[model samples]
Every structure is written in C-alpha cells, then in structure tokens.
Target: MLANFHQEQSTKSTLVYLTLSIDVARELTHVHLERFLAPLQCLRRLELVIARDAKRQFLDAGQWENFITEYLPRLITFEFKFSSEWRIGQYKLDQFRSPFWLDKRWFIAYDSSRSCLFTVPYFVPTSIKHSFVPVSTNLTTLPIEQHMVFYDRVTELRLQEHLRSLPYRYNHVKTLIIDTSCTYQNIIDLSKVQSLTVDISTLSLSSLMTAIKRSMPCVNYLSLNGSYWELSYMSFTGISLEQVRVLCLSRYANYQGDNTDKWSRLFPHVERLIVSIVSKSQIPLLIDQFKNIVSGFFYIDPPYIEPHNNDPLYVDPSYIDQIHIDAYNQIQVTHEWLMEHVNRFRQSNMDNFTYQINEGDRLSLSLWIGEDDKTAQVVMNSYFKKNIVDSMRTVRSKTENLSSNTTTVITDTSTTTTSATVTTSTVTTSTSSSTSTISTITTTTTTATSTTASTTTSITTTTATTVTTTTTTSTTTTAPYCTTRVTFDDIPGQSSTSGVVPNGYKNLNWTNVLYLNSSTMPTSGYQTAVNSPPFVGYNPGGTIVQITTANGTKFAFNSVIVSSAWRDNLVWSIYGYRSGTNLVYAPFTMSVINQTKISCNACSNWDTIYFTSSGGTPRSGLTGNGTEFAFDDLCISFGY
Candidate 1:
C-alpha cells in the first residue's frame, strides 16, 4: 500500500502522521518499515506496533537513531513495540543511553522474562499478564529510580503464578485477574479494582475471600472460575460478599443441586448473573435461588444425544426432531420449549419477567426480571402520578376550546346560584342565597382575581358574598449546600495514610488523583497545602485531574481548596461539562506556601468538572513543567 501510494500520489512526502501495525504472523523487519516510511520526510509523529521476533539488529537503538536522522529529519515523536519468543539480553543498553537518544528524552525498557521490548509509556500496553514469580529487566534507558514509568499505562493485570515482592508498585490497576493466592495485594491498589476474576488452583478460597473483603471493598463485578465441586473444598460458613452486584461463573463452574444454597450465601447481594446451564429447567431454579437477581444470561448447552440409538417413537417433538440429529449433529431448540419453562416460573413466582433469546450457534437466554416488590411499587406510583398530572392538563386544554358565543348560567332564587366559564376556563363561581358565604380558591392559574363581599338584610331578602383566595406554589428546587467534603481522609476499607482516590469515592468519579498523607511527603505541596488534612489529593506532573458525579447527574460545584504540588504560580484551567457540552470554563493561579480557594458560586448543574495545569515556576529541587497540584475539601451540591 505504501509503495502504491508513493507511486500514485504527489503529496506522499507531505505526510505528517502515520501508524503501522504489523501482523504477528508476518515476518517484518526494520528494513521493510524503512522502505515504507523513508519517503515521508515531513512526518512529525509515527507509531509502530511490531509483532515480529526480536532480532538484535532490529532492536539496536543506534540503527534507529541513524535511520531517523537520515530518512525522517522532521520526526518529533517515535513510538514502537517489539515482542519475541525468547529473551533479549542487555548488550544494546549502552546504545540507547547515548546523547543522540537522550537529547530527545526517548527512553526504552525490555522485559527479558516476557521477551517484550517497547518505548517507555507510549508503546506500553494497558493490560499485562505476568507470572508473580520474580522477573528481571535485561535492558533499559530509564534510570533505576524511574522504572515505574514502564508499567504506568497498565490498568488490567493478571497474576498467573505465586506471589513475591517486587521493586515497582502498581497503584492504578482497576481490573485484576488472578490464578494464584491473594498475597500480592500490596503490590497493586486493591481499592481501585472494580472488576476481579479469581481462578485460584491451589489457594484457600476462604482466605482469598477474606482478603478480597478486607482489601478490595470496591470490587463490584466478580468472576469465580473454578468448578463448584472444587470451590466446595473450602467452607463458606461466615463469608458473605454483599459488595458484588454482578457475578459471572465459568462454564465449568456450575451451581446446581446441593451447592445452590452454599453459593447463595456467598454472594447474597448479586443482582446479575452470567452462568452456564446444561438444561432449561435450571434457569427458573436460579431465579428462585437468587431472589435479588434482576437480570441474567444463561448459556444453555444441549443435552448429550447418543449417536445411532434413535428410535422413531422416542424422538421428542418439544425441542428436537430426528432430522435435527443427522450425522452432522445440527441441533435446534424451539422457542415454545423455552417459553413453556419461562411461563412455568412466572406462574409460580408471580414476577414481571421478560426475556430475549438468541437461536444462533450458541443458544443463550437474556432475562430481565422485574425489580423487587418495594422498588416496583415506587416505580408504579411515579408512573400513576405522572399520568394524573397529564390528565388534569388535558382537561384544562379541552375546557379552553369552548366558544365565546356559548354561555351557561344556573340560578335558583329559592336556594343558590352558580356560574360556569362562558368563554374561558380561567374563572369559576358559586353563590348561596341564605346568608351562606362563597369561597373560591385559585391555584396554579395564569389569571389574577380580587374578592368582593356585600350583605343586605330586608324582609325575605338574602345577600350572597364571594371570597377568592390565591395560593402560589413554586416548583423550583434549590439544592442544599454540600455538607460532605471530599477530604481524602477516613475512607472506608482503605488505608487513610496514603492511597489513590478510587473512582467511586464519596459518590464522585475521580481521575488521575492520588491520596497523600500530609506528613509523609512534606517536601511536596500535597502535604504543605493541606485543608482538613493529614490527607489531600495530588496529581502527577503534566496530568489533568477530573471529578464527576458517578451516576452522570448534574451537580453544583461550590468550591475547592487547591495548591501547587511541585511549583509556584501554577495556572489551572478549569472546565465544567453538562453531558458532552462545555458549560463553564475559568482559569486560576496558585502558590506553594498557601492553599488557594477556587469558589464556583455561579457554576451549577455540571455533570463533570476537570482542570489542567501549566506554566508554573518550579520550586527548589523540583523539575519539569510543574503541572502538578494538590487539592482538598471539595464541596458540591445535589438535589437528592
């Protein structure tokens, strides 16, 4: 494609950006890549995903430096990744340390155990699976103190072997998959992991469960992959995982027969289930088992059918026929069979149930059960209230259709007299003759009225008086001032001393912020500019910090206390978002010695808020753009 483009297009040399992903099965090298990119001398940025075996010649930093200098003189950014079947040694590390590579701040790291080499951060994959056993880095241009940058992009980590102490820490991994024991909790931030999959082969389930409850309190989606018989080896006498709302079981992990009760006790609050079942009868059984289950996905496997043993009279017409069981074994499951089972469950449970079935190669049922009785009642009540208001509006609209030529009046001198709206529905009246007072209450109407009253007494003479009262009800609701400040202290089931702010802390979504103890890093501004500390929130250099409502609802942004974490006079560019639109934007400057108050008195109804920092003078011993800042006591308001 590149050669063809060069041959046909005169603007090939004007290319400014390029991305190439080489297939793993293809034998590609630097020579082939050079032939494609060498003509694009004006390219400013290039990304390469190389999946070939790591040859020393291709991995040489000096070769790449020479190639870039000669062929791509305008290239400002270069990112690449190379993986091999065998380890690459450290012989080429010196070449990457030369002034040619160091001048551009392009660093590299190689994992010998995994036989992978990549540019630091830019080419780093976000997901990594590693054996917990110790490994070594055979080559790198990064200093020993800066090795953590190699794993900075990792968000999902898998541990496949036994645990051991490591030199680096992973505080950002939010989805963890483990096959060994849970002893490596200290290596990564447990509170950050919202989804976890456990398939321990030799670890004690009870101990692992205890660790999960004690350390990983934020995990809401859990997958247990062992078979029920294997999982039953450990007693779940006192364990209850109420935090897990979505649960998944591997195809081998069947919760049937005697293990149903045991499994129910373990995940008592599970609202959704994804599991495999051998028969359709198990679907209703599972629904009855987990009374709180609001939805589920059941992969129903066909029953084993014996080959060449078919009797013409024994063929069942309910689900399958003899023709479906030909030598090729193409099976068909009837919709009537599934509906029969579903109706049976509904008849017994008396719940509002819905289902959608896919009759493809893999038969699966997606069920959405009604909410529990209490929740259903609330929903039904809201629906009825809405309909009632709509009906009243319709009546008012119809009443206004009366013609101006039409009039209705009823008068009985012996008793009382009443008047109807002649041309409009805005006014109504009633009067009594025998000294009875007339009261008219006006509510939520567009017109204004005044009351008049008079009385006359004579022989057999009566007087009628009318009184009108006006009542105004306001529908505007004012949200209460935020009583709860995100102090980064006293977080439940987390270390208050130091940690990263989990996504759902205090009902707000946090991004790129760290929880720091005020006393631990006094040299840093995260501690120096504290409000209600011992704890505060900080961001790494050159990163934006974002705070948003977890449920995506608009809330009021009251104020926040902020300070420069690594510099003085840091400029913060603040933006507030409603849905995807920018609603508010402002800029503020901060100092290192004292905390600055950013008050958002006019900022309201924002679903997300984020800030970026730049152009700060670095403090002593600090370096770089000084785009880091610390914050505490964030105040927000919501209606409910």
Candidate 2:
C-alpha cells in the first residue's frame, strides 16, 4: 500500500520528493485514512502533492496505476512541493514505517474560535488545490492585504519563476496595485499592464522612475499620489517618456514646492496634466509656471483659510455650506480666467489652437482631451449642486415644511408597565432617523401593581432654533501702476562663451530673469537690485532694450523712465508712439530728471523704446561736468 501511494503521487507530478519512509506508508490503512484527514471538510479540498525528485527516485508505472485506481479521490491540482532534495537512499528505515509529513499534507484544520483560516507554516500551502476555483465575483482592481481574503499579488519577490507564474493568479490584469513593499524587480515584468498608480508617500521618486524605465514600456498613463515638496528636484537621465502621455499628479495640501519643473523634467512629453489645487489662490502661480501643456485638470480641494503667521489652533468642520460654495466659485473664476487668457499661451506660435474642458476627479474640475464647455461646467458643478440642493433638500423639507409635528413609540415588558412621551416642535436640527411616533402602554392589573408598588413616567422635549444669514460678494479691478525692479530672468537661453548677456551688458545665470551686469556672474543667480551700484543698470555696450510683445501687439504705456545719469554730454534717446502715435525723440531734447531718473519726454503713450546714447551725440539739460551715459532699471507706467 505504501509503494502504491508513492507511485500514484509520483504520476501526479514531474518530480516526486518523499519525506515518509516505506514502513509509515505500510502502517497507513483505510481505518487510519479518516483519522489522518479528520480536519478536512471534504476530500476534494485535499492537495494531491508529490515531492520534487531530481535524483532519480521515482516509482514504477505498475504501482502508479494500483495506487491511483484504488485509494485516491478526485483532486483539483497537483501541488509540487518546495522540498530540499530527493536522495536515492536517504530513508534508512523500511519505506512502510516512514513518518508522516508535518505540514498540510492531507487535511486543512479549521479554527472555529476565530472564524477564519488559522496561521500555517511557511512551507505549507495556505491554499489547497480547491482554492483556485473560478467564481463570478467580477472584481477588477483587487486590494491585497496580509489577512482576511487578502492575497499577495505582484509585489516584492525573490525568484524569477514566481514572476512568470503571476498570469495564473489573474487571467488578464490591466492595472496593478502595489504597496510600499514592492520593488523594481517585482513589477518590472508586467508586460501587458497599461496603467500604474504610485503612492510616493513611501517610495522614492528615483526608485519609481527606475522601475518605470526597466518595465513599463507599454504603459502610457500614470498617476502619482503624494506631496510635490517631496520631489525637490528631478533629473531624467534613464527615464523613457517616448510612450507616456497622460499624468494625474495629486499633490496634497501640505506640499510647498512647485511641481512644474519636476513634471517637465521627469515626464517632458506628457500632454495632459492634472493637478490637485488646494486653494484658488495658487491658480495664477501654477498657470504662470507650466506651459505648452495640451490639457489641464484642476481638482479644487475644500477651501482652507490662510491662517496668520503665528496662530496655532484647530477649526471644526461645522461651518455653513456657503463657505464650501465660495471656494468652488473662486475656482470657477480662475477657470474662466484661464480660458479667457488661454490664447496668451498660443502667442508663442501654435498650429490650430482650440479649447475644450472636462471634469477630472468626480468632484474635481478636470480638463480631459475633449470638447464642449457646457459639459465641463455641468460636471464641475455637479458635486456642489448635489450637496447644496438635492441631498440636503429632504432634511430641510422635513424640518421646515411643518410648523410642529408630534409622534411617539411604545415598548412593554411583562415584569413592568411604564409610560414614556416625546414631543418635537417648530425648531429642528439637520439630523434624521426613522422613528416618527411614540405610545405609552399601561397594564391595569391590581395584583401586579401590589407586588411592584412603583410608578414610572418619562418625558422628553426637543426645541430647534433657526438662524438666517445673507452674504454678498464683490470684486473690483484696478489698472496697474509704475514700478521698477531688476532680476535678469527672462527666456531665449544663451551666451557667447564670454558669459555676456545678449547685447553684452548682463550674464545669463542659467535663468532668463534679468540680472544686472556686475562684470562677474554670481552663482546664486539673483543679485540684481536697482538700489545697488553706481546707479545700477547697463550701457549695453552697444545693444539696446528693444521691447516688443510676443503676440505682435503694440506695447502701449503712459510714461517711459530710464535709470540714467543726468550729466552734460551724457544723454539717452527714446523711440515709440508719441501721443497715441509712433514717433522718435532726438537725443538732445530728451529730459533727464533728478540726475538718476531719465525721462523720455517726447515718447508719451509709447509702444516701444530703445535706450541708447542717441548716436553718441552730446545732449542734456542743465547738469554736472562729468559725462556718463549708463542705463539700468526700465519702468513703464500703464493705466486705463
């Protein structure tokens, strides 16, 4: 019987490893089968496993037939054991007297105490052959945990064979859910997968990018859920963005750093960008930074009032619904501004510019790559509408419809007869329950009353107070005034190897912003202040500040002032619209104010100007003996 069982098990697998001796198998009989399998609910759930045998220790065909045809029952699968090895003669004792395997060999013991699967050994298969039965649960994205029905899916693993076997777990998985424990190797081979969600709260951006480079060749969509501040900076060296196109980045409220550069660096070619904007105030800054994006999805979070610098306290969430509505309205205004000024971005020259918007998250004002502005507004406002009108309407109607309504409920116990009453009037809270009526029960028994000798009564009353408030919102627009500041940070990236800015006055410190010429560039990149240095600015050596808008529109302004010295024979000329028409000022007559502020008197309502030495001609008002012509900060005053 022992040889027959071993032979049958051997036929079930390519390799058979035996832990039991021949004597033990021989001692097992039909009478002992139940005792050995007493913990199993049914024989079908038993795994028909055979140990791996690479050392040529398998049984013959004749024994294989005898053992299978006689003792074995119907089984679902063959569980190939992860045993050490099979030696030809390791069992010194008689084969029939071998010890039984210690793990889940023939039975799965149930634990009625906890109503769940008990802890099993690592070597033991927690799930038997019957565990892989196909059911009609129809679940798409399964979240795996350690206990309950949770099962480890595509996560950290040691061997390559385990990775190859993942297809058996799920027939076709398009999306994967991996937690912090997942490594680059674990998900590097999911070839068919198309979308990936990374929780950067735990994993580093470098590790995630490495995995993406190694594995996600076909994946084009990605969503990152974490703080943008965590991504202080990113340099894309090995990351492949040839296929990736869409990204939904949800930076939490606490994130401070700008994610524009990070996103531009890591996924340079991403076409559709979605971001979680905590408040409407960040809209202008976010818009000013990121450019050339095809679509935008701005998910507006609940409004958080900007607390003062030193104030520390927690605020409850019981504020009125109007507060929430105002936040949404602010976002609406920002969205409108974006749509109106969207053409401003196209000024840099685009092919066939058009517009469309859509909802991003269910409540988020996301911009999908599609059309129809009406649909976008509907989707964006859906959440606020539901919460404000439809969802709360039922509760409000219950309280406001009736001036006063009363009902009661009654319960009775044989041991005691008690009476209870409850009354509700005019004022009411926004709370709700199913109970509407209350009744009192009195059992009139002289003998019962005599034995108890007690009287019981209860009374309850609810009073509701209603407070009404009205809020009005107003907005005002004012024209911009004149102000001058210097920081050489603009665009058109370059230098002539001499570290000289265009036209030779400043140096490009890797930033386009204006940085005043100091003869040597500072590493900090922001050392330009008009308040500093021999009156701060530039003679441009020969180059001039030729102002023009990117859209070919006239750069109209009321007054033009140049930071130049007011000295004899040191005069700067100006050219532009004079009194709403294009004109140029002769170098000699230009007004130099206060020896520090040079005024372009003739170039009023100017559209353009070139601050130069007026063809080197000596010209000025009453001034000093020294001749010095230098220009620094340029201020343009515009008003309606």
Candidate 3:
C-alpha cells in the first residue's frame, strides 16, 4: 500500500518535508518504513501520526535513532504520535528517554489512558477538533526538570456546540473555527487570533459579530461557511468588518446579482478575496464591488454541456442539437472573457495600474497598484531589454530592405514614451589611427540627404546624416575619487556565525547591522544576497541603521549594490547627513536574488548616513513580509 501510494519512480526530488498518518490495519513493517523514507534523503522535517497499532517495534527509540543516524542524517526536526493497543505497563517507556533525544531537547510524553506516546511540543496538532484533553505525564532524560506547554504549537482550534471549562491557556491560536456557543474567552486567548471561520448554520451572524467585536479584535481573514439562503435574509447593516483583508466564502454559496453589495458592505477593507461565482458575468460585478481588491482566487463553475439526444424518451427539442463544450474550449473562452472584462475595467478605473490573470485550479488575478522606485527600476530594466530586442529586429528588417534595393527611409526621432525617452540622430564617421599615436576631432561638418531616383532603379542609396556633432582634442588626467571599496570579504572570521564591523576597521562606525558568512550559515536570505565569496552585511530587524566616520571625517557616498534579504519589492531608504542636517535621501525597492545598484552621487561631504527598510511582499513559498536587506560593494570616497 505504501509503494502504491507513492508511485514516483524517481527519488532525485529534493523533498524537504514529509508527513505520514497511517493506520496499522495494513501492518507496517520496518522494511516498509525504510523503503518509504529512502527516497527522501533531503528531508529536513518529518511528522508521523500512527493510530490503533499493537506494533511494539515501531515504538523502539533505538531503532529510530539508528535509522535516522544512518539513512536520514539531514533530518533536523522529527515529531510523531504513535498510539497502540498495548496496556499501560506492556511496554517500557525508558527506551524513549535516551541521550540521543535529550541532547537535542526533543522531549516526549505518554498518555497511559489513551495508550499514546508522542513528542513534546512538536507533536501538538495545529488544528484540534474540540474537547482537547491535555497530556498528564512527560518523561525526559534531562537532569533539569521543566514545565511542558503543548498549546504553543496550536494555531487553529475548532470548537463544538457546548464548550467545556478547562484550566488551560492558549496564546498562539491564530485561527478559531466555531459552530455554536463557546465559553472559550476564559481559557483561550482570542487576542492573537487573526482568522475566524464561523459555521453560521448553527450560530447567528449577529452573535458571531458580537463575539468578533468583543474578543477577536485582530481577525483579518474571515471564512463564513453556511447556507446562502439563510445568510441572505439576515441583515448586516450595522456590522462592518473593516479589519478583514482576506475573505473566503463558502463554495456552496451563490454570488449572482445583488449578493455583490451584501459582501462589499461586510468587508470594506478586503484586499485579497477568495470567492465562488455562479457565472462568468458575475466576475465584472465582483471587481466593481471590491474596489480595494489587489488579488483574488475565483472558483468558477465550468460551463455545462447538453448530452447527446439519442433516446426515444427525449423530453425537449432544444437539447436535440446543442453544441458540445469541451474542457479546452471552455478554458479558452474563460481566458478570453477575463481579458475582455478585466482589461476594460482596468482601462476605465485603473489606467496606470498593471494586472496579471492566470487560469489553473482557480482563476487568479493579481494587480500591481502602486510600485516603489526599486520595483520600477527592475521593471524598467526589463522594458529596456525588450525594447532593445525589438529595435534590433526592426534594424534587421530595414537592413534586409536596403539589400533588396527597396527605398526604405528610416528616420530616428527624439520622443518620450510612458516611462522612457529615446533620442536618435544619424551619424557618419571615419577613424584612422596608428600604434604609436591617436587622433581626436573637436568639431565635424554636417550634410543633407541626396534625393533618390525612380523606384525601378537598381541603385540602393544609403545615407547617414549628422544633425549635430562635437569633437575635442585635449589631454588631461585626474586621480580616482573612490580609492577604497568595502566588499566585506577582507573581514576576519569569514566562516563565523556573525561579526560586527569595528569602528576603526573601515574608518566607519556601523550600527545595528552585522556581517555574516553565507557559506557557514546558508540561510534563505544569505544564500541569495551574497555577491562576494562568503560575506554579506545585513540588518535582520527593520531598525534605523547608521554608518559614520569614527573621527568625524566627511566622505562622499557614491553607490552600493543591495538585494532583498527575504522578500520581493523591499524598499530600502538611505539618508545622508552632515552635521545633524539631512543632505540627501534615496529610497529604492529590490527583489530577492537580484542585486540592484543604487547610486548616491548627489550625496557628498556627509559625516553620517542612515539606512532603513520598509514595505515588501514575502518571497515565493515564504511567509511574512521581510523588511530586511543585504548590501555589499559599498563605494565611498574620502576625497571630499
């Protein structure tokens, strides 16, 4: 069964996390477990929940220890809950209390009544379904005794109709799924809850709103799963969930005509929406209603097709010759419909904004409302590259035309587009130089284009005209202003965890930032931000960092290469100061893995500089907004 369940023949995938919840009905053996885990050599974390098993061999810690040591050496975190039918004293628990687990602080707990042995803290489920009885006994090999708190790992909790009174505290629960009444305020900490899923079939919307207002103040992601007809009749006039930014509606709910206004009034600050619509026409109404929506996932119903009418009992003549709509055709129609509707709305309402639509399991539309200077810079570079490619293609076509003896008048002009400007003037030049000497021209003459003859003529006249030209002949040399470039590679302890940039080392006082070797600690941010061999400087926290001369000497801040540490579109701001006065300020946005050059040429003779980061979207497959940034190749000058 395990072999058939995972049919992937290749084991070359870098699978990092694996979770197995198996029942002992199939009788899992040690060989089966080894074969199942053999392909996952790169697994970093593993969680298992085995139920109703009398297999004493599965609970042997020494076997697990040896298996992990030999086969899964890359495994850093392991959690499991093995429930057996064995009696309280049937198996010895001392095998679990070993140096291998104790040194790593991986504690375990046993519930003799339930016959469950599980890892402490790590094995605690995130989402629990009602009446959770806390574990009583914890066994460990450590000398120092410590209190074990299990609810720290619980992020989502589902409650029953009747809540039980328990003397327990939960501070980390972020999601609360409730169906009916609850006395949870006394035991559970709803202050930290950000998501609330209410089964309104059993509970009243008004009562839920009252509870949200009283308890769940931080709730921003709300999911209402219940009957659509019942919810429509209920009035939500006075209730306004302004804090909700992400709203997920029940798939069973109908969102046809007037329902748009109902949901719009309820969630006014909704930026991310997950919804279900009955027809494609409702998409425009949704976009019109939710003006604040930046991105959305829409579950659209596929078009229904009529079956072939070959039976004698066919009821309606209208269904006799109906066109069949296949999945491919339906998807194409959907794509075209989205482009037509969404682009029309964007042109009228959001002219300056850009949006992208994709078709998959769900129709996703993400809009870029307002971008920072850094994001703009990245977009501009791509746009420039595209234009260059297009211009080359155009030039190639023109060259082909010239070779074919066709009269092609190509005129380059100075004009400005939306974000870029182009200026062109045709020029003709001749260069002649020797090995020992070189010639320079200060001024050059211009000429007009000669008139062309008839089209039948085989002569292909190609003229390069100069509108304005200037040349100079002089010899002057100057010393380089930027004599030193700090690359962070010369710092001692290159492979250490972290090292601070000393005051006198680079004649600068670095504050609130540290340099770390990416090779030693290959974290997500450091791996992408490292430009040099091993070292890169960064401030993990979004604090106001500073760089100042130790002896109060002034320097010119030229430029530096910077990258986002853990996010995309990260805005990094740098302010140059001289004698407590702000001289120059520059702010730019950056994406992870892309090192951007930020020029601070205007900043000169500054005694100090302040750096701060703010506002960035999380990188792909990562959680939370990262306001941290990494920087290297700082070019500064003391010549000022």
Give the top-scoring candidate (TM-score).
1
Give the lDDT of residue 73 in candidate 2.
32
TM-scores for the candidates: 0.50, 0.30, 0.40
In terms of lDDT, model 2 sits at: 0.33
Q: Which stretches of candidate 3 lie over 4 Å from their true place?
A: 1-55, 58-107, 111-116, 126-129, 136-148, 179-183, 229-235, 255-257, 301-328, 331-640
Cα lDDT tens digits for candidate 3, 467-486 = 44564232223223455677
Ten consecutive residues with minimal summed lDDT in candidate 2?
A: 395-404
Best of the two (1, 3) by lDDT: 1
Error of 1 at 6 (Å): 3.7
lDDT of each: 0.57, 0.33, 0.54
As for lDDT, the candidate ahead, 2 or 3, is 3
Q: Taking the tens digit of each residue's C-alpha lDDT, what string does model 1 give over 1-640? A: 5445567777878886677767672455567667778889988667676676655566778789899999998675576777767565566766788987655546677766667777664454567787342223446775453444444446688987655666655655767888776478667878667778887646666777887778887777887776533446256666788878777764422333345556667888887777655544556567667778766665533353222223222223334334432333323334444445554444655444433323333344555565544221101111222232222221101011111132222222223444333223333333432221111111111111111111111111222233435632223223355655788886766674556578788888776566777675555566545667578877643345668899776787666767676666665556677775666555455655545555543356678777666555767653222356777777777642
RMSD of candidate 1 to the truth, in angstroms, is 23.5
